[model samples]
Target chain A: MSAVTYETEALTGRDFPERAREELRDSQLRGNIRKATTTIRAKTAEVTGELPDWQDLRRAGQAIKREAMRDLARNLEALEANVSRAGGKVHWARDAAEARWIITNLAQAAGAEMVIKVKSMTTDEIGLNPALAAAGIRPIETDLADMIVQLGHDTPSHILVPAIHKNRAEIREIFMRAMGLDHLGDQPTELTAAARRYLRERFLSAEVAISGGNFGIADTGTICVLESEGNGRMCLSLPRVLITLLGIEKVLPRFEDLEVFLQLLPRASTGERMNPYTNLWTGVREGDGPQEFHLVLLDNGRSRILADPVARETLHCIRCSRCLNVCPVYERTGGHAYNSMYQGPIGAILTPQLRGFAEAGSLPYASTLCGACFEACPVRINIPQILIHLRGEVVREKQATLGGRLGAENLAMQGALAMFEYPALMGLAQRLGRVGQKAVERDGRIDWLPPGLSGWTASRDMPALPPQSFRAWWRSRRGRP
Target chain B: MSGAREAILGSVRRATERMPTGVVELPGYRRALGLDPAALLDRFAERLKDYDVTVLRVPEAQIATTASARIAERGIRTLLIPPEFPEAWRPSGPTLVPDSGQGARELNEIGGVMAGCCVGIAESGTIVLDAGPGQGRRALTLLPDYFLCVVLARQVVGLLPEAMPRLRPAIDAGRPLTFVSGPSATADIELNRVRGVHGPRTLDVILAG
Candidate 1:
């Protein structure tokens, strides 16, 4: 990779643990995340639980995604052809820089000084707004949460609700200060009205609009965007030129396949039975929305992920954020802890693979292996298993870098391995541990430890070594020699 | 750029070729939904109502009267209707504006818009609007503050699977299709839903028997 590309894409380099530690100190942030996640989680469970055939729908979703990823080349070719036949241009982006270059060039070619955007995670992943700003073009976020985030000069903290970390008061403060509105109340209706009035002018005046596709149907060359707010629809409808940045994995084989995903995404993301609006458009028409259309298929690290047998399930993610809501770790530290465009359990597994182990190696260890994410996943991605797999990769990478020299962790593992191999040593160690426990024991628990081992006891107490080893007790009960 | 496309496709092909993906059976999905025709229409109306969308169930003869009442109730002045909209269903007293490729500026000035839906799904309270005769361009339905959609009983389907095949013709013609569940809304602020964002703030559905 070019140094320029590396420098640009390495935007999120703060380690997960450090960021999480800092985030845990914020009580207000924690309460906001807790309330938002609790509400969404309950609603999600209610709606998804109502479906008697939910498991069937999940399986179908998984199967459809797998088929699409497996046969992506053919489907993409078909999509390009269909889109071209319908009067839209398709561009191929090998990486983040290329995608940004293509989109920026498109905007410049259209002579658009500014563009209005729908909430798109892919664009955020590519750092498109910064890139656009660098090219002397302004990109306005029309989604209420995204607008709040942008106005506050903050990054998005959640997939579904970008400003879930901020409450209504914080939002009102943002509007009062930044939006030139004074005496704004902290009610949701007033906040939404302020955002609506602010964004309506931009929507009407915007010459070009950029969005992310939820599903790209190769059968009809259609791009589908599902949203609760009308901002996406406005961006899709008002602008004369529409540019959609889509991850290559989003394509489906047919329009019929949306049946499964349409059922799965809304419930999993926002816990709505159905979002307010679902916009599906194929290319351009003479006098309809977006007379000029472009679709940039981005593969910023997805193909590398698709190559892995055990880890390929990451591609099946629908960006639902259910895993984020249900994740205990996410509930505590929230999205900022992960330090990537993606967050929570899915982020723990996905971010490492997308950004590579060297940059995001610590992400896989962010999870507690609670398996809540797996259950919450609409496509049933085995996130805990992937986390363990990526942890192994990180360990192996470190070992290879060290040229086989044992690190402290490896030395500790070697000691444990030796003890496991020798029964007499194991017995001796257990007996010694009981005696050693007296120094640290307090009320039958060990609360603190030395530097290297303190992380274990930091959040939880370790039970003091038993007075009698199980093997010794067994031997005494059985009257063994 | 073509080179990039070739390389990417090559990588995908090589990657997928190594893994053995098994064929999956759909497993009686349609049978599991178990929706009846009349019940489906009622379910559709009920679901849309949950989103605060007004659903007016009237006999075919009362479409004009009910539509006019809804428009009058909303106090809408200028109304935009598709050129191919049935004259019998067009409400009186409001100055009728034809949707003849009106830009966002022109459309935004109108108070309300009325269109016909291609199909309605009961399972997910959705109305699909393909840019056809009765459904003008997408801008008309979107720019106005209030929207009234006309849905026939026959257009209602039990589930999405039953609805997709019917749109095959529209899909083949590459018409821009929009599936609207309710008026524009946001749950972004504290996860509390507030209606009326950029699309029509009010959605009134007239279900013609």
Candidate 2:
């Protein structure tokens, strides 16, 4: 029932800058990203402004998440006890491979040939579909966006709308080619109709179902999933056997903590006060839902993140993707530029910590330190500060590998320190620098520079040695010299 | 799996070694609207109407007549109802489909489902069904295209905080619950909203006194 080969996301050899350069060239992708983000950004501002106590809500959200992290062990124990008392089986997985093995065994135990799924970012992060496919169990995506992505044989680009990179025409073509249909127009409603017809039978007949929890309450051992389309209800209700995979960080201390996240997530993600469907189930019920329930609690590098006091807040993300909508870099390059399942500012900080700092060094530098992500964050994560901390960690690691010192960077810092130590030497160098730039100056700016320093000049011109340096002009004006 | 659980829990315990096992004060949205029953009903109806869910308010005596009219007007040929539903509330127009542990395919063939809600949230316009009494099983209300729910005015709660305590019994009993705010809708394709996906495409509320 279990196999060693699970299809997780493969790492591209290319870094963010390389992928961003390619994404930037596609004007159609750029237009799609910009239009979608602009609409969501405006709508979020309007809806979030209606509540006068939004700041209080944000603060409360942060506090509750902090409390959960502070006492995760106790809450987890309570959750396990409650789930056991309610007759649901619990399994723990240390990484993605172990998680896949557990879920595959469950599906096989139930004699399931195919499984239905709701839209869950955790499953995407662990690459659950490909694994299930490899084990000869077909996993069908029931969400509208996920169905589109699965049919198109593409990866998800955005968190909320995974197929945001594709327009309606592309979706129609995917439906026609994949589902073997014709005469479909480019209207979203028509394409949705096609999906509804295609997936309805599967939803009714699928023997097993898999989902990722939005919030897990420790006290009641209840799992909450919020979704707009009724696919979530279908997946949660119709199947005979159910399996849910959740990250360890999704636990809340109490069942009532849902009010805060329920307020924060929908408004931030889709600009709605509440989504259409919010499903909560404690465990296996006799005649109602699935007869058997299994929960797989996945670590997958979260404990390492929890150990870091400086970077721990990255775990508080509710996967809202609000930061993505407000991000200029994400707006221009789109989610595909990030080269990971998680994208945008939240992804920039979270991906590195989850995968480890050494493997994802370039992710920290992906941001412009614009502070918009922090401002838009529902939990007030202070993402910029975390990025800076990760940057320092990367720099320190690199320096250690370079025999305790970086070559050019070390020499430049030493030179600056030496200059700052002597006022006369600094003044003399400033004068010499003014004279030194004459060879490269073109219309008072240097558009090209020497080797090793050409990266700055490649993007924009550098002001050629500002006439005299501010200190020199200040001294001259005051006649202090 | 046992080894994995121990390893995971060990790592978590080590990571949170500095945490104290005491009562931690957490900031939360503690505001609960203290509205009277009538005001709460009005607010709940308004909120439900805001989501494009039709809300019809009538006296308790008129519930049977109104439900019959609604079933006829909506052209519902077969309506599904739980075994515990009030005999008086059954409409005279449509053929009532009994809750006989029907499968998804059978439920899908039904025209509509009418159930009694356990609670109504005023702030979010939500109707919660706990699979108790006349609510039937989860699949009955989910597979059908149209859902008509009856919510007594007294069952309306002002906020989520006020509602959760009332829902504790169902939560503890591990009953399957559904929180339906409006008809099934999606903004997946280019963030444009299109209604009627997998769940019921139409939701009508009978706010009876």
In Å, residue A383's CA in model 1 sits off its true spot by: 0.8
TM-score of candidate 1 to 2 decimals: 0.95
What's the TM-score of candidate 2 when only chain A is evaluated?
A: 0.93
lDDT of 2 by residue, B22-47 (tens): 76565545568777878888889988
For each candidate, the alpha-carbon lDDT, in order, equals 0.87, 0.86
Error of 2 at A302 (Å): 0.4
- The DockQ values of the predictions, listed in order, are 0.78, 0.73
Per-residue alpha-carbon lDDT of candidate 1 for residues A69-144, written as tens digits (9 for 90 to 100): 8888899999999899899999999999999999999999889999999989899888899898888889998888
Every candidate's fraction of true contacts kept comes to 0.78, 0.80
- The residue ranges of model 2 lying beyond 4 angstroms of the native Cα positions read A1-13, A403-432, A441-446, A467-481, B19-23, B28-30, B34-39
- Give the alpha carbon lDDT tens digit for every residue of A1-481 in model 2: 1121212223545677878899999999999999999999998897688766788789989989989998888888888888878889999999988998899989989999999998888887777888888888998888998888888888778888889999988999999998898689888888888888999999989999999998889999998999988999999988999899989999998877887788788888888767899999988888888888999999999988889888888999999999999999999999887767788998889887777655566889998999999999999999999999998887677677664376787677668989999998899888998898888998888998888988779888988888878888888789554
Looking only at chain A, give the TM-score of model 1 against the true structure. Answer: 0.92
